[model samples]
Target: MKIDNEPDIADFDAALLLVMDAIWSARNVSLAARRLHRSQSTISASLNRLRELLKDQVFVWDGRQMNPTALTEQLMPQVSDIIASMRALIWRAHGGAEHAHRRFVIATSSYVTALFSAGLLTRVADEMPGVSLDFIATAPNSWTKSVLPDIDLFIVPTNVARTRGLHTARLYQDAYVCIGARDNAQLVADMAPDDFLGLRHVGFSSVPRLTASHEASHWHALGITPNYVMQTPEYLSLPAIVAATDTVAIVPGRLAQAAMRDFALKAVRPPVPVPDLEIVMVWKPAQNDDPVHAWLRGALVDLAMAFDA
Candidate 1:
């Protein structure tokens, strides 16, 4: 049976709603066209259609800007509500985030994996036990659209995850510290820049070197490079190697703190100061509206906030 007084929307479309809202917010057809990335003529056509549907002038040109008509001013609240409800429905699909049962694979650098794994695992287990997560080593250098199908996220240093077209959000900031055996004679609470540079180093080169941009700039400014004795693709292995040899490694502060108790190691400030490293969470724009994936992203972002605290 047909429901009575159901508010017929047979002729309405989301594009007209968006055009109406955009024009209202912008107060000018040309400005609204720019905001919506449409030509002014296109916006005018949509506006004409909206006028026909509502049977109102909708707006009036007041010399400087478009002013909403009395009918439009009254109807806009409902229009805006409709748009908001539509977006909420889109984002909250699939029974919302908490109830989603999905597997997500994230490609991340070793330092990020080591630093966040425990917290992320616990969060998923506690909140959404059905959710499964996997972490794999990030690709060496290819941050392209072709790799999007393989991974849900990329947790890497901002400089390394620099896919010009992908979406990126700041995860956390960290600084590099020098780690070595506690008994190493050359290790000190604070050493000279030359002393620090002169020591043999074990470098982390998983995502184009942990010294991606910020630390690299420091070395460049100092006019010297760390004398690397060895290199590894993961940060977790650095502690064991440093504990067994005279060679020291430069690592993220949080990783060094976590590794110190597991290995007989001590962390000291690097002799040369470097800017804080910006670690970011990156994902394909196509996944932006996926509720299950957004849940995982939210979990990681929350963990990052607590880690920074």
Candidate 2:
């Protein structure tokens, strides 16, 4: 066989290959145009271009039926292989969602889970029906080194920002706001700075070894310690506790919105300056180039951006 040395073929444009495949399968210009929902003139023009590029008449009319010539026969197998490979390449590039049966494991806190459960999961289910999700909550320190081989992604508060070998993106910013019982007489008016200092407060603290700095850190920079009546490790319980008791708690705005609907709670601007919490999505650098990971990350960031709207 003579090797036809030609300028490198532009990577087969998938659309053009599909058109060629349609013509090959139908074996008639009118039939292929009908199958492709295109005009016969358009199909003819594309075939002319294909013939010019390949330097061979790929198809010819033999009375009523279309026939392949010797050159076309030689190229048929290669063309079919190229078309099949191109189909798989497109599917994989699109994350193989149509046939994906893989599971994705994510490390995240309960608060993050609660915030994204409804809307995020619904989108995931609709787009990737064959994929399953697992969310694991890990403590700040342990999460740094706890590498699960199956964990495809990590969603955590940006406070745990310094993870080695991970790519991170800020999903959303959560600001602190004071929440109080809707019926509380003291909360009827805007809370004075001193009122915040005087009121019994509920806080969430999981770590041992609490110091004055720890207690005052969330408050204003002046370092006035809050009078703590109760402290719990679970942030989810804060809404219930504040609803039953007169205790006030500073919580993330998203949680405060959720709590306000369930409990008779009013969200107020915090009396003290508190740092804004950034929720971030993270994954191992090795997975950064994975098509599925990129799709999931884009979906998450898109969801987070919708919250602001």
Candidate 3:
């Protein structure tokens, strides 16, 4: 079969490319529709058009399953590669990382900000000096709703699951550790669970609630209840407060490590097992193919891994 050499035939069509890519990734019409946020009928209609353009049945039903035909199987890898190359070319044309002046908005918690924003910002400044970053402190309940539409990326704890139409990748896992002033008398080798419950706890309550229900749940399961004397939204400020007074806070090991230098804090393993913190980077599927976004995501994952290492 002779391939069309017309310029129009060579030009990329984003919509068709997306449909084909989705179908390939999903392996089913309904699943593709869900991923693409299109109705099943709409996806089916698009598939029909794709079949005519590609001159192949592409996918066929085989006992309640959509199986790729031999033509599709042969074309799949090439088409996918073409789509990826086209996306890179488009991003390059629009000024990629070297020349791009794009602003990346991120929705994340203050705790995460304390742990990563400094390192990430420093790296970004050195690499993409023209690019700007806007960090918004996202509340637990309002993360999905409050994230800016123009947000390039969002980093949050794994406890916050991704909504439909979003792509998430786990960056790292952290565990809760008890942080206290280094000079605190309670810094002993044999610390008991009751010792933590008895101490005046400085709770990092980003919201109005005095107790973190997740932490409470873990403690409840262990038959331990923290006696929080004061609750504050800012983890950064907690170090100063704890430095002045002998209050302890249950915080992520990363945060504890970051604050240790300034506040003379010691990181001790929690007596009760707290849920492991899964840091995830999330973004919209629409931006998945953007070269700059891909670079930024890759850089972040690398940075996180390096930090962990």
Point to the candidate with the largest TM-score.
Answer: 3
- TM-score per prediction, in order, is 0.68, 0.65, 0.70
In candidate 1, what are the lDDT values of residues 1-309, reduced to their tens digit? Answer: 557744368777788988998988899999999999999999999999888877789998989999999998777655654565465466556456456778888888766887888998998787667788889876637655576788888887776567665666677888888899999999897778888888989876644444443465566786768887777767778999999999998888888988977899988888876667888777776775465666677777788889757
Error of 1 at 134 (Å): 1.7
Local distance difference test, candidate 1: 0.78
Rank ordering of all candidates by TM-score, starting from the highest:
3, 1, 2
Model 2 lDDT per residue over 189-209, tens place = 456778776888887776654
Q: What is the lDDT of candidate 2?
A: 0.71
Per-residue lDDT, model 3, residue 59, is 87
Model 3 per-residue lDDT at 307: 68
Residue 223 displacement in candidate 3 (angstroms):
4.7
**Residues 233-303 of candidate 3: C-alpha lDDT, one tens digit per residue:** 76667777777788887877777777777777777787766888788777776777776666566667667
TM-score of 2: 0.65
